[model samples]
Target chain A: MNFDIAIVIAIEMNIKVQNISKSYNKIKAVDAVTFEVNSGELFGLIGPDGAGKTTIFRILTTLLMPDEGNATVAEYDVVADYKAIRSSVGYMPGKFSLYQDLTVEENLEFFATIFGTTLAENYALIADIYIQLEPFKDRRAGALSGGMKQKLALCCALIHAPKVLFLDEPTTGVDPVSRKEFWQMLKRLQLKGITILVSTPYMDEASLCDRIALIQKGKILKIDAPQVITANYEKLIYDIQSKNTHGLIHDLKNYSSHYSVYAFGEFIHYIDKNVDFKPEDLQQYLEEKNHSDIIIKKAETTIEDVFMDL
Target chain B: MVFETLQVSIIIMNKEKIIQVEKLTKTFGNFTAVKGITFDVYKGEIFGFLGANGAGKTTAMKMLIGISNPTSGKAIVAGLDVATQSDLVKMNIGYMSQKFSLYDDLTVNENITFFGGIYGLSRKQIKEKSIQLVEELEMQNVANNLVGALPLGWKQKLSFSVALLHEPKIVFLDEPTGGVDPITRRQFWEMIYTQAHKGTTIFVTTHYMDEAEYCDRVSIMVDGVIEALDTPKNLKQQFKVNSMNDVFLKLARNIE
Candidate 1:
C-alpha cells in the first residue's frame, strides 16, 4: 500500500463529457448524456444491457467515434489525440478475445509484445497477479478456467500500466465466487493509483464502486455514491413474497398506488404510495384482497431501483 | 487453502460414492485443462461444477458425454465407463452447451426434429415430445419462428427443453442461462426442478453464486483441480461465510 506505482499525482483532476450524444438512424443510443470521472477514482457505469453502456465505453476508450458531442480522456481530445489516449489506457473488453489456442503464458507474452515491451521488463508490475496463473502457464488460454482467464486478461491489460483502466462488464458470466475475487483484485489494482472505469449490467456490483452512474434508455438517470443515490429514492419499496409469487405482479399492478413491481430472483421488489403506507395497512389490504401469508417488509432502495424508477 | 478445503470435502462426499471418478484428467498437447481429479455424481441429485472461466468444466462435460476422450484416468457416468461405452452413455444422457446448442436459422419444430433424429427417437416419439415441450415452455405462438430471432432468455428455456427431448437418464447444462434476464433465469430453474422430480440426474455449471445454491451438491475447481465438493449450505456453513460468493472468494485466494 505504501509503494505507489508511478503514483500518478495529477494537477488537473477532471473529465468533462460535454453534451455528448450519439444515435444510429432513428435509434438514439446515447442521448446527450454527460458525466465526469475523477482522475484517480474507481467509477462504474451501471445499467441494463442495450442501455448504451457499451456505446459509452467504446466512445470513451476511443473505439467508436461519437456522433454529436465531444469527449476528453485525461485532458486529451478523444478524436484528435486518439493515439495518445490508446497508449495511456488499459482496457479489458466485456468479451474475452485473447488467443484461445495459445497457453496462458503465451497470451500474456503476446499482449506484452503488442504493447512494445517484454514480460521481463514489466514482470514486477504483474508479478503479484501473474504468479497465481504460473501453475497454468502451460495450459491453453481456451482451457483455462473462467477465473483464470479473467486473471490473464487483467494481467495483459496491466502489462503496459495504462493510466486509466476501462473494464466493460468484466464479471458478466463469471461465478459469484470468481466475481467476488475479481473485485478484490480490482481494489488491489486501485491501491496502485490506477483510475478505473467499469461497466456492468448487474446492479449488485454497483455498490462496490466508489461512485456509480445509473444509465437507462441511453440516458444518465443518476450519478452519485451508491448510498446517496439510494437515499434519494423517493418511492417506498417492499418485499412482497407469498404463495403464487409469480402471480403477485399482475395482482399488484392492479393496485391504484403501486409504482412498480418486478421479480428479483427469490423475491419481488415493489414500489408503492409512500405517503400513508405501513406494514399493517398493507397486510390488511392484501388480506381483504384474499392474499395469504404475504411478507411485506420495507426495503432500502438499491441501484436497480433507481434504474427502474427511470 | 480454499482449494485444499474443497479437496477435503470432495474426498468425504465420495466415501459413499454416487459419482466415481478415478484419476480423470483431460489434456491437449502439453496443456492440461483438467488434471486427473476424480469424483462422483450421486443419483437423483443436482450436481454443480464451479470453476473459473476455461477451468475445464466444458472439457470435463464433453468427455462425460462421450464427445471427447479423456487424456488419462477413468470416469463412469450412470454406471457406464465413458471410454468404452460412448454410444451407451449418449443414449442415457442429455447435453446443452453454453452456446445454447440450437440452430438460429431453423424453426423450433425443425430444431426439435434434428436433435430427436440424432438421439434415435421414433417419429411418433419426436412428435409427442415436441408437443409436450412447446406446451411446457408456453412458446406455442413462436414455434414457427426462427429460433435465432428469439431473445436470450427464451432461447435458453427452449434449449433446456430440447436437451430433454429423449428423456435420457442425465442432463448436462453448461452456463445454459447466460445473458438472460433474472426473471427468465428463475423460470428456467423451475423447469429444471420439474425434471429433477422425475428422477433425472442434473449436472450443471454456472458462474452465478445464487444459482449454485440451488444445486443439491457441488464441486469447486481451481487450476484444473477439484478443490471442494459439498452442498451449497454445507459449504457456506463450514466456511463460516455469509454467501456462496464469500466461500468461493475465500477458497480462490488460497489457490491464487
Candidate 2:
C-alpha cells in the first residue's frame, strides 16, 4: 500500500461492518447489520442469546465467512486479509476454551508461545489480571473457579497484545463483584489505546460501555450512547408492589389503558399508554380488588426498558 | 405414652421447617468447601443462596440435595435426613442445574416424557402433564420441535417446568437464569412466584444481586462460611448500601 492510502485507511474507522448477514438453513442469525467502531472506543453489542452477536464477532474475527455484506478490522478486509485481522484482534469466547488440564501459568505460556512471543515480552499488558491469578498459577484451568478461569482466559487473549479486543458475554454466570472488577480491567485496557467490542446479556452492564447497540432476533434495534438511548424512552413508567405480587401482574395486564407490564425484581414495572393516566386511579382500582399495602411510584427508564420497548 | 404423643404433636406443629440444617459442613480433601453453615428454609418461601463464584454455594447446595455427603453436622430436607435418608429426601425434592439439563436432540415432549418417567410417572400422567406444560408456556407450536432448536430463554423456561413436573415438596434451582436476557428472566421469576404461591418451597442460588432481592430471605456465603443471612431490605441496610450488588461488594471486600 502507498503512504497516502495507508494514511487514508488510518483516518477511517478501526472496525466497520456494512450490511453483514448470516443464516443457518432458513433461519437468519444476523440480518443486514451495519455498524462502525471508532478507534479506541469501547463498543458494546447488547442483546440476548440467539440475537446473532456471536455471528458478527465471528465475521469480524475472520473465523467464519459472512453469507452477505462485508466487514473490516483495522482497515483490513475480513476475507482478503483474514490473517492480518487475526493477528490484530483478540477474542474471548463465551465458553472458557483454555486447556483445562494445563496449569494457569502453562496456559498463559502456551498462548504467548503460539503468538510467537513470551510473557516477558508483553508482561505489562496482562499484569493486572496476572497478579490476581498469581496465587493459583499452579492450579489446573479446569480446577480453577469461574472468576479465576475468566481471568486466565482474558490473560491468554491479551498475551499477544492485539490492537482490538472482542469479548462475547465475558461476565455471564460470574458474580457481581467479579463482574465489576472485570469491567474495571477493561477500562484500564481502554486507556492503553486498545479498541474493544464486547457483548453481554446484562442490561446494567450497558451503562459501562462508551456506546451500545441493542440487537435482537438478528437485527439492530438501536445504537447510541447509553445515556442518550435511555433518555429517549418516551413513556411514563411506574414501579408497583403489593402483598400479592403475582396477582398484581395479572390484574395490571387485564386492566384497561395500561401499556407494557412486566415483573422487574420484586416490583412490577407498569407503563401507562395514556400520557395523562394518574397513579391514584390505578391505586383505587387495585384497592377495589383487595390489594393491600400497595406501593406505587413513578420510575425512571433504564437501558432494559428501552431494549424491551424496542 | 402421653408425653411421647405430645412430642409428636410438637414436631407436627413446626411443619414450616421444610428444610432444617444444623451446622452443615463439607470438605473436599484438605480444602473446606462449605464451612459449618446453619440455616432453615421455610415452607413456600423463596430462599436465595447467594455468593461469588467459588464461594462454596454449590457445595452447600449439593449437600442439601442429598447428592454429596456432608463431613459433619446435619440437614433434614422435607422432614427426611439428607445423610441417612437420602433416597427419601431425593424422592420429595426436585433439582434444576445451571447447565441445560434436557437432551438437545430430543423433542420437547420427548424430554418431558423422559423426566416424568424418571420420577415414576405413569404414561397417562405424563401425557396430561406434558399437555398442560406446553399450554402454560405457550409452547404448543414447538412441542414437537427439537429442544436444540429452541432459543435459550425458552429452553430455560422448559427446563424449569420439567423440574416441577414431579410436584416435589421443594425445588432447588442452581442459577436457573444464568446467561438469560432480562425480559425472559423476569418472566421466569414470575413463574417462580406462581410456584411459590402454589405451596412449593423454592431454594435458588445466583450471583445476580437483583435476583437476590426477589427472594423472601437470602444468605450470602463467602469462602466456606455464610457471611450474612437476612431479608434483602435488611441486608441493604446492614451493609449501608442502596442495592444488593453494593452490599455483596462490601461483604466480599473483606475477604482475600
Candidate 3:
C-alpha cells in the first residue's frame, strides 16, 4: 500500500513473506519467518523434520492460513486472494497423495481437468517428466515405484501451468540416482521461467538450489547461497580417521583441546577450542592410545555442519 | 569402556558367526524378489545393506527376520536355521522397522513396559532394565511424558533401545535414520557403534550412502541381486569413485 513498497513489488518478485507466524494448540509451528524469491529462482527450505518447512509451504500454497503476518505468491495475497493463489501455485505434498486406484495417465488427466485445463494444452511443460511416466501409463498409481510416483506427482502439479511450484520433501525417500535426475528436471523447469520452492531433508541437495533457508525448530537460522553459508562457518575443522573408529571418537572426546566432535560418514569432524591447534598433537595422542591406520586432515564444512554450529 | 573390554574378550574367544545365508532366493509367481543372494554376518559387526528403492532389500530382510519364507535357499541366524526353525530365529533377533515402533499415545515408561512385556520379560527384570535404559539414553527427565511429546530424535533413540530390550544376538534396522538431522544421525551411529562393541551384530539397511561408509562391510543390491559386496574402501576403489554416493550412482545407473 505504501508508495516505496509498491515500487519494490512491481519488480516481479514471485514470492514474498513478511513476519509470518503459525501455531497449533500451544506449539509454534512457524515463527516470524520472512523471505523472498525472484522470478524463476530455485529456492530451497532445508531442514529436518519438525522444522516448520511444511507449514510455510502450506501457507504459501494457500492450503492453510497463517495465524499472523502476510505472504503473497505471484503478487497475489495468500489470505485475501486464496482462490487466485491456489491456481497460480503447484504443490506436491510430502506424502504421495494421488488417487491409488487410478492409472498414471488417468491421474494426470484428473488433475488437469480439475484445474480446468487439458494435458495437451500444457503438454510441453510436463513433457520431460511425462516421458519417464509414459512407459507405465496404464499401471495404477499405487503400484508405481517411489521414484516413479514422485515423477507422476510432479507432472500432476505442473499440469495446471502454475507460475510457481511448491514441492515438500520431494526426494526424501528416493535413491541417489533418482534424486540427481529429479534435480535435473527442476533445472530444466527453471529455464522455462517457473519459480520453484522445494523443501528437502538432505543437506547434500542444498547446493542444487540457487538460495536456501536453513530452518530448525520453527525458526529460520540463515538464508543465502549454500556456498556462502558453509564458507562462513567460523571454526577450524578436521576429518579424523583411525583403524578403530569407535575408539577414535571416544579418545577424541577425552582430548583436552577438542571443542566439538561429530561423526561424519566414514570419518569424524573435530573442532578445536584453540584456533591454532596442531593436527600432529591429536595424531600423537591417538597414536599413544594404540590407534592405527590414522588419517587426519583439514576438512571442508558442509551445510549440515553450519546448521549444527548455529 | 565395558563394551570395549567385552569386545576384546569376544575376539579372544574367537569371532562367531551370527547370520549365515547360502543361495537365498524368494519369488512371487514369476517375479523373483531375491535372486539367489548369499552372505554371512559375523558377530559384533555392523553390516550395511545398501540399495536403491525397489532393489528387493526389504524382501531380503523379511526373510532373514523370519517374517517371510524364502522360496529357496538357507539362512542360519543366531545358530538356528531360518527355513525350518523360523520361530526360533524370530526369538533371537531384535527388529526396529523403518517406521520406528513406538506407541505414540503411551507414556515413555508405559511404552517400555509394553515392549518389555511382549518380549516376555518379567516385571522385576523390566523394572530394572527400564531404569538403566532411561539413564543410559539420558531420558530420565521425560520418563513419564507421552512418547508423542518427545522430539523425533529422542523417539528414534528410544525405539532403538526398546528393540534391544530382549538383548537378541543381532538387531535388524530397516532404514533406521531416515529423515533424521545430521547431528542426531551422528548420535544414532554412535549408538550403533556402542551396540556393536557390546557383541551385538548390527544388520542395517539404508538408502544413505554416507551411512554405508560407517559399516564394517556393505552389500549393494540392484534388482534383487547383490551386484557388489565389500568394504566401503574397496567398493570405491573398484568403481573408481570418490564417495559412496558416486559408487551407488554408478551402480544404479547401470540398471535399465
Which residue pairs show backbone clashes in model 2? none
lDDT of each: 0.79, 0.89, 0.89
TM-score of 1: 0.76
lDDT of 3 by residue, B1-256 (tens): 5796577557635867788889999998888879999988889999999887778888899999998898999989999888888888877889997575898999999999999998889999899989999999999899999999888888889999999999998999988887888889889999999999998999998777888889988998999899898778779989999888999998887342
The digit string of per-residue lDDT tens for model 2 on B153-200 reads: 899899999999989989999989887878888889889988999989
Better of 1 and 2 by lDDT: 2
| Candidate 2 wrongly placed segments (more than 4 Å) | A1-13, B1-15, B254-256
Each prediction's DockQ? 0.26, 0.66, 0.69
lDDT of 1: 0.79
Per-prediction interface RMSD in Å:
3.6, 1.5, 1.1
lDDT of 3 by residue, A1-310 (tens): 6867655644654899999999999999999999998777999999998899999999998889999999888888999999988887899999999998999999999999999999999999999889888989998999887888999999999999988999999998888888999999999998877889999989999999999999999999999999999898888789999978888889999999888898887788899999779889988999999998899998999997888888
In Å, residue A27's CA in model 1 sits off its true spot by: 6.3
For A1-310, candidate 2 gives per-residue lDDT tens digits of: 6877645644643899999999989999999999999888999999988899999998999989999999899889999999988887899999899999999999999998998999999999999889999999999999998988998999999999998999989999988888989999999999877889999988999999999999999999999999999898878789998977778999999889988898776678899889889999999999999999899998878899888888
Model 2: how far is B25 from its true place, Å?
1.1
